[model samples]
Target: MEGVMALMRPMPVSPKQGVTSPRTSVRRSTPCISTDFSKRNGCLIRAQQLDSTEASTTVPPPVSDSKDNALQLKEWEVGKLQEKVAASQGITIRRRPPTGPPQHYVGPFEFRIQSEGNTPRNILEEIIWHKDVELAQWKERKPLVSLKKALDVAPPTRDFIGALRAAQQRTGLPGLIAEVKKASPSRGVLREDFNPVEIAKAYEKGGAACLSVLTDEKFFQGSYENLAAIRDAGIKCPLLCKEFIVEAWQLFYARTKGADAVLLIASVLTDLDIKYMTKICKILGLAALVEVHTEREMDRVLGIEGIQLVGINNRDLETFTVDISNTRNLLDARRTKIIREKGIIVVGESGLFTPADIAYVQDAGVEAVLVGESLIKQPDPAEGIAKLFGKDISI
Candidate 1:
C-alpha cells in the first residue's frame, strides 16, 4: 500500500531551468504554435516542436528576433542622419562608420560583411578613412575631456606669424619654415636615421623662422612625443603641429602638446570646420595655417572671417602631383589683391627644394615657404638651410 502511494507522487526533476526531460519518443510536427498565454493549458506546454526526421539533422534558429531587428533599424536610421549631417557641413567625401545588426558568434569561424564606404576608392580617400579609424581609437585613449585639463598647465605659445614676418624682413626672402619630417607617402622615407630633436636644433641653427613637425605617425612616422620633446629641449623656434586634422578635438590636443601653430588642410575639412577651428585657435593663442590647393578652395577660405595666414600647397595631395608654378598661378591679380586687402600672410608650401624654388614663390608674393624632404635629407640640415636661400640668412 505504501509503494502504491509512492507511485502516485510525481518524479524529481533536475534544477537546470532550460534543460528538457529525456524522452524515448520524438514530438510530432505541429501545424502552428501560438505564444499567447491565454491559450496555454496552464501546465506543461511546448513552445517549440520538432519532427522526428528533423531531430537527426540540426535546424537553424531565426536570423534575428524582433528586439534585434528593432535595434538594427535604429542603427541604420542613425547612420542616415549622420550622413545628412556630413553632407550639410560640405563634407562630400566623408563617410559615417558602419552600423547594422550585431553579428552572430560563430566559434572559431569569423564572418564579416563588407558595407558601403568600408573600402576606399583612392589614396586620398584611403588616408582619410585610415585617419578616421586611427583618430577614433586615439580619442578613446586620450579623450578631449582630459586634454582640456592639460591645457591649463601647458606652455605658452610663441608668435608664429610674427616670426615669419621678422624672418622675411631680416633675410629679404620668404621666411623658412623648416620641416622635421621622417617620411612621406610620395617619398617613402626622407631620413632613415631620423632624430626629431636633433633635426629641430639643426633647423633652428640654420635660422629657420619656425619649424613644421610632422605629427602623423602612420604615414609620416612622427608623433606628438617628438613635438613635446623638441619644445622641452629649449628650442625657441615656434613649433607647428603638422597633422591631418578632421575634428575640432585635435586643435585642443595640439595646444596641450606645446604647439604654437597647426596645419588645416582645405581638401580634407569643410569650410565650416575651418572657420570654427580658426576661431578656436585664436582663443587658444595658437596660429592656424589654412592650406589650399585650388582656386575654389582659396575662394572658399578667403570668404571666411579672421583668417590670418593661408598656405598655397604646390603639391596636389589627391594626385601627389606637384608644380611650384601653382603658387604664382593661385596668387593671380584678383586673389593677390584680395589677400593684400585682408592683410593675410601668404605661405608657399611643398615642392620647394632650392634657392630658386624659394625665390620663385617669393616673387609670386609668398611671405613664407614650408620645406621638408630636401632640407631634412641633407647630411647637415643646417648647411642645407644656407644652400636653400643661396646665402647665409642667419647673419
Candidate 2:
C-alpha cells in the first residue's frame, strides 16, 4: 500500500556529510511508477517489472517534502549521534538498534514500539528507552552547553564522602543516607501526604549523615525543586541528587540545583562512562555514588578510576526483586579486601528495614546505608530513623 510504503521508505544518510543540509531539499532518484497493459494478437500481456538496473543502482526519492524529510532525517541523525556518544564511552547498548535490511525498509517506526510483538523486556530496558525520548525533549529546552554558565553560579559542593566516614566513626554504626522519596514504580506511592522539604528536615533532625533526594519527576514523583527547597531550608546534611543520568550534562545541572553528590548506577553505565563521568564529577567538585546490584557490576566499577563511593543495591532494578543478602554476597572476602585497600566507601542500598537489616549490611562491610521505604512510611520519619538504628544517631 502507498501509505505503508510512504511510512517505510529508506532514509537518506546524515546531512553532516554535506550532501545536503537537513534544512534544504534532498535530491534522490525517483522510481518509475507504472502499470503496463498490452493486447498482442487478442492476448493481454502481463505488466513487467521496472528497469532492474535502475532499481538496483538508484536511491529512493525523498519520503516527502523538504520539511517532512528534514524532520525525519534529523531523528535518524540524532539516533546515530547518540550511538556514537555511547560507543565512544565504550557502551554497546544502543538507544535504538539498526533495523530491517541495510539498503531498504530502513524506517524504525514499527520496530521501536512493537519489537518482537512485546513491550520492553525489563524495567531497566524500558526506563532506558523512556530516558532516550525524554532526553531529546529536555535537550530542546535546556541544552547541555547552556548549563555551563549556570554551573559557575552553582552552590559549593559538600564533603559527601567525608561526612559518611565521620558519621560512621561517631555513631559506631553505618552512616544513614536517608532518602526523600514520594513514590516508586515498584511499591507505588509510599506517602500521599509527602512534603519533600519537611521530610528532609525530619531526616536531618533524626541524625541522618546525608540525604538522597529523588529528582526524577516521572516514575518517582520527585523533582529537582525538592533538592533546591531542601538546600534553601538550611538542612545541613549534604544532599545527593538521585537521578537517572544518561549523559555528563546532568552532573553539572545537579550541581546547579544544590546537590553535594550524584548517584551513578554501574548497571546502566559502562566502565568507560563511569571513568569519564567520575573525572567530570571530580572536576565539578561533586562526589559520585557509583551503585551496583551484582558482583559483575561491582567488579566492573572497582576497576574504574577515581571511584570513591560505591553503593551496593539490594534491589535488582530490572526485576524489582529485593534480596538484602545481595550486599553481603557481593562483599565477599576478596572484594572486601580490594575495597578497603582502595579506600572505596561501600554504601548498602535498598530493602533495609530494621536494626537487624542495618546490622547485617554493616557486618558485610558497608560503611553507610541508603534507606527509604521503612523510614519514610512511619508516622514520624524522625522516629523511623531512630527505629532503623535502634538509637538516636543525630549530632
| Global Cα RMSD, each model | 18.8, 12.8
- In candidate 1, which residue ranges exceed 4 Å CA deviation? 1-92, 95-116
Once fitted onto the true fold, the runs of candidate 2 whose alpha carbons sit more than 4 angstroms away are 1-113
TM-score of 2: 0.76
- Every candidate's lDDT: 0.75, 0.75
In candidate 2, which residue pairs clash? 207-394
Alpha-carbon deviation at 300 in model 1, angstroms: 0.4
- Indicate the residue-level lDDT of 164 in model 2: 93
Please provide, for model 2 over 1-395, each residue's C-alpha lDDT reduced to its tens digit, 9 standing for 90 to 100.
23322423444555474333333332222222111112112211122222434233323224555797557656655555545655655444444323211222323322211221113445565566567667778778887666767776777888998899889999999989999999998899999999998999999899999999998877799998999999989888999999988777678779889999999987678775687678778778889999988787888888886789999999988789999999999999999998988999999999999899999999999999999999999989999999999998877
Q: Candidate 1 — which pairs collide?
A: none
Q: What is the TM-score (0 to 1) of candidate 1?
A: 0.76
**How many angstroms is residue 119 displaced in model 1 relative to the true structure, after the best TM-score fit?**
1.9
